[model samples]
Target: MKNYWTISRKFEQNMNRLQKPKKETFKKRLQNYLIKFKTKSPQITEKYKYFLAGFIEGEGSFYVGLKKNSTSKYGLKVDPAFSVTQNKTGVVHLIAFMVLFQTGRIDFKSGSENTYVFKIENRQSLVEKVIPFYKSYVLPLTCSTKKQIFNNWVNVINKLDQGVHKTSEGLAYEILPLVFASRTKGKREKSLQDYQKLVLLGVRQ
Candidate 1:
């Protein structure tokens, strides 16, 4: 025998050449990988993900504040915050949310008998982490009102990022009428006409 092993190797190569492996598309490859990995140890549990989304849909708020500030550049300050208010009995849930998200603070609602609010006021954290997470996971599951509010909030943030909030009076004028419009049970600012008057006074001063 010349070499049985060499002959067997050549035969296997010829067979593989006739029956080549199928090329998978990138989408399919990614799907397969996600399916394999999702079950192992997902970053967040399905229970927590949907629960948070639903809770926000029911009780959360996205607020973009544009108030007259004499000390700030352009005589205006932008305060963008996210909050979810719940009864005192649900403090544990709020705490759980804080632990899971690693952002926001739990506090008693002022002038409230049995209410607490979980609020996140850090601009950097909201833009970089919290907002992005909700946009991807929580937003889709929310109602149209919540979605619209979030979209407006994001618009304010984008304008702020471009320095439009500081320099462009037109931008602030355009956005102020939209902020806090959906707030139901909390401090609702005065009418847009009042705001316009205030802004005009600030510009004159």
Candidate 2:
């Protein structure tokens, strides 16, 4: 009877060992996961896109640059640009803005205080990519002031495409006035009244 009981106990122990799960190493678990996992590029979601647009409505600037260039037909060149400025605390939004557009460059500006700016300066990118993306996703929801400025800026760009900014008179009478007038109040010396004064004064070095 003692021998029979001992043999039964040994058999039960063997059965428990066989039923227990095996311990796996971290590397083995990761390897198993990789077998089923696939990697792809990161994508911008629609919700983030709308958030960026609203953010821009508050902090962005659409600028049209008119600078003296004697070699050009107008003796001035039109440099149309889009930019958003923010403090260091707002750097995340700036980064997201860059990612959404996937085209501009980030820069730091130092003045009375330091700030960061994400700027799009390339004409091709502005007209083809930046402008269209905003037109479709952002512009429709922009506020009145921003909408007015944006509309004027786009018109100037379109006119530039048609070669309207190629002559000195054209730049003085058409482009400069439109650009300066579109900016927020108190930005320039004054409004369209100072357009000629600004042009004749030449750009400050």
Count of backbone clashes, every candidate in sequence: 0, 0
Per residue, candidate 1 scores C-alpha lDDT tens digits across 1-205 of 5589889999999999989987765346434533533422234577877777777778877877666777865566668888889897666666556655666666689999789898888888788877877987787777787677788787777766777655445544765655545344465566666666666556624
**Candidate 2: misplaced stretches above 4 Å?**
1-43, 112-114, 187-205
Query: Listing every candidate in turn, what is its Cα RMSD in Å to the true structure after a full C-alpha superposition?
Result: 17.6, 22.8
Whole-model alpha-carbon lDDT for candidate 1: 0.69
Q: What is the lDDT of residue 52 in candidate 1?
A: 76
- State the lDDT of candidate 2 residue by residue for 1-205, as single tens digits: 9999999999999999999999865345434433422322234688878777776777788988766566654345678899988886666676666556666755686572458887888888889878887888888887787888998898888888888765646667877778876677774544564545545555433
